[model samples]
Target: MPDSDKLAIAAHLHVLLRRKTGRVTDTEWMAVNADYAAEVVRFARQRAQEDGVPELADWADRLDHAMHAVAPPAARRPLLDVATQAVRQRAVPAAPEPVPEAPRYVGGIR
Candidate 1:
């Protein structure tokens, strides 16, 4: 599955876990979503190996969004934890960093 999708799934689970009970850190997130975490790790490895699949640099971000937990960009421990767990498992494809389409130059030329 796509790295973002994997992360989304994991994040979804994380949110559920948090809502169902109490607070959780990155470590706890890993413990809770072991399977999805493994998937994220696997995806990262594939990208590192220069595999055919698209590389997704912001898999963590996607997951964070899915989890509905918005923190500073610097604070990505939760995302990392999920990816690490996934990598420990089987291969998971990561969509490469999106080369954003050029923004529409709506402003008048200087």
Candidate 2:
């Protein structure tokens, strides 16, 4: 890919990562964004190789350096798991319907 294309891809990846995950806690950073961070570095490296942007390679190096600060991905509960647990903890049983009363008879009726 051309240098410009690679740079654009890298920027887009970073923007999307930031938007989807927001600012992650230090413990959750890699679990949420490692793949995205790696993708940005991959594209940045490609950008550096294309024609004239040596700075792109520098960017890729910096990105790699930053990646080390993030926590490594670890086993974490999915959102569904958390939601299901919450529902179970507070579940309320459905109320039963009452039976209808029988019709009353009139003494004057034949």
Candidate 3:
């Protein structure tokens, strides 16, 4: 999955965890920190079992898998870097298309 998708999942899980367990977590950190993510996953799973909420367990499972699948920090590029490279590569900007003028009626009633 793409990094954006993974981050989205982490954000969603963060909100769910907060609402269900009153535990606040940094969504961005959770996306990159495997150890923190693992701890969150364990806590979520334990709460799921205790509260008998299968949905929470499923989310925790997803987080666990996603965290394990993430690339190492060194291998991952920051979004700012990608944007900067894109900006640098664009040598010229494209001209905007011209808009057509609408026809005007002369008579009050036709």
Candidate 4:
């Protein structure tokens, strides 16, 4: 998954934790800090079990997998090759289509 997606999930989990357990957390920090993320995950799981809220447990499981999963390395190519590919893609650009006109209100009876 992308870093942005991870950050979004972390933010959501942070809000859920705060609302359910009154524990405030830094979403940005959690995204980068594995230890803090782990602590939060454990707390969430424990709370889920105690409160019998399966939804919280599900979110915790997602976060656990996202944090632990290894991200694949980005593909790299020669600068010339990349430039040639870009030029080739741009060589046959499609023509832009005309935009549709918006409907106008006629005294609230359009």
Candidate 5:
């Protein structure tokens, strides 16, 4: 799988855990820890399989490690302040758009 896909898997896992447990930082830290990589991958793969997204299972381990390498957002400020800033700035980045097909060449040279 591509690096972007791996990152997206990690991000998706984080979001799911946060929603399920109502914990953010702790959940993120757990997701990123190398020691739990296998377990994390297993859970993610199972979820993916259940969701009929088997492709996600292919790089689950790599995604977990990559996620571990990333630093979770700092929590220096209050949650309310952070949320307010996100609301104001639209902090959540949109997913990248798919690339369009390249034009076909006809002549060898102009």
Candidate 6:
């Protein structure tokens, strides 16, 4: 329960959010992520306090400012791919076995 731990929790929450929902299309995911980020701002302050910091809002803001400093598409493409794939793969059903049809008897008059 330290400042570092609080920051880690915030980072984890973001990653965890990203890793959910297979069919969450990129646009949908992005929108949802934006929402989560907004929510996390509030959560991060609470989390930092839970982790034993006073005035966690200030600490959370600093942590987030550093996090947001990372802003290159190339910087995040791999993470995005991993999260999307993990979700998509989990949602997909396994290939089903084909069932053979029973042989039909020809009419006796045939």
Best by lDDT: 3
What lDDT score goes with residue 71 in model 2? Answer: 39
Better of 3 and 5 by lDDT: 3
Q: Candidate 5 — worst ten consecutive residues by lDDT sum?
A: 21-30
Candidate 3, 75: how far from true, in Å? 13
Report every candidate's CA lDDT. Answer: 0.49, 0.55, 0.83, 0.83, 0.60, 0.51
TM-score of candidate 1 to 2 decimals: 0.25
Please, what are the lDDT tens digits per residue for candidate 3 over residues 1-110? 56677688888888888888898988888888889888988998999899887778888889889877746689889999999999888956788999898657656555
- Please say which candidate is ahead in TM-score: 4 or 6: 4
Alpha carbon lDDT of residue 81, candidate 5?
A: 87
Cα lDDT of model 4 by residue, 14-105, tens digit:
88888888989888888877898888889999998998867777887777788887756565567999999999999997999999997687
Candidate 5 residue lDDT tens string, 1-110: 34565556666666664554343423444444555555666776776677765555655655666655544457256889878987978866789999999656757553
Per-candidate RMSD, Å:
23.8, 12.4, 9.7, 12.8, 20.3, 14.6
Which has the greatest TM-score? 4
Displacement of the residue 57 alpha carbon in candidate 2, Å: 0.8
How well is each residue in 2-108 modelled by candidate 2, as lDDT tens digits?
A: 33444444454455334443422222342235576576567656755763556656755655665555334564568998999999977977688997986576675
Candidate order, lDDT descending: 3, 4, 5, 2, 6, 1
Worst 10 residues of 4 by lDDT: 69-78
Candidate 5 lDDT at 15 equals 67
Task: Report the number of backbone clashes for model 4.
Answer: 0
* Pairwise lDDT winner, candidates 4 and 5: 4
For residues 1-110, write the lDDT of model 6, one tens digit per residue.
24454456455445433443111123223223545545555665565566554445564464456445545666556878899999999999999999999556666543
Candidate 6 — number of clashing residue pairs?
A: 0
Q: Candidate 2: where is the Cα deviation over 4 Å?
A: 1-32, 70-110
Per-residue lDDT over 1-110 for candidate 1, one digit per residue giving the tens place of the 0 to 100 score: 33455445555444543443343435345434645555544544445355332223344344434444445777556878888898876576666897878756767654
Note the clash tally of each candidate. 14, 0, 0, 0, 0, 0
Which candidate do you rate higher for TM-score, 3 or 4? 4
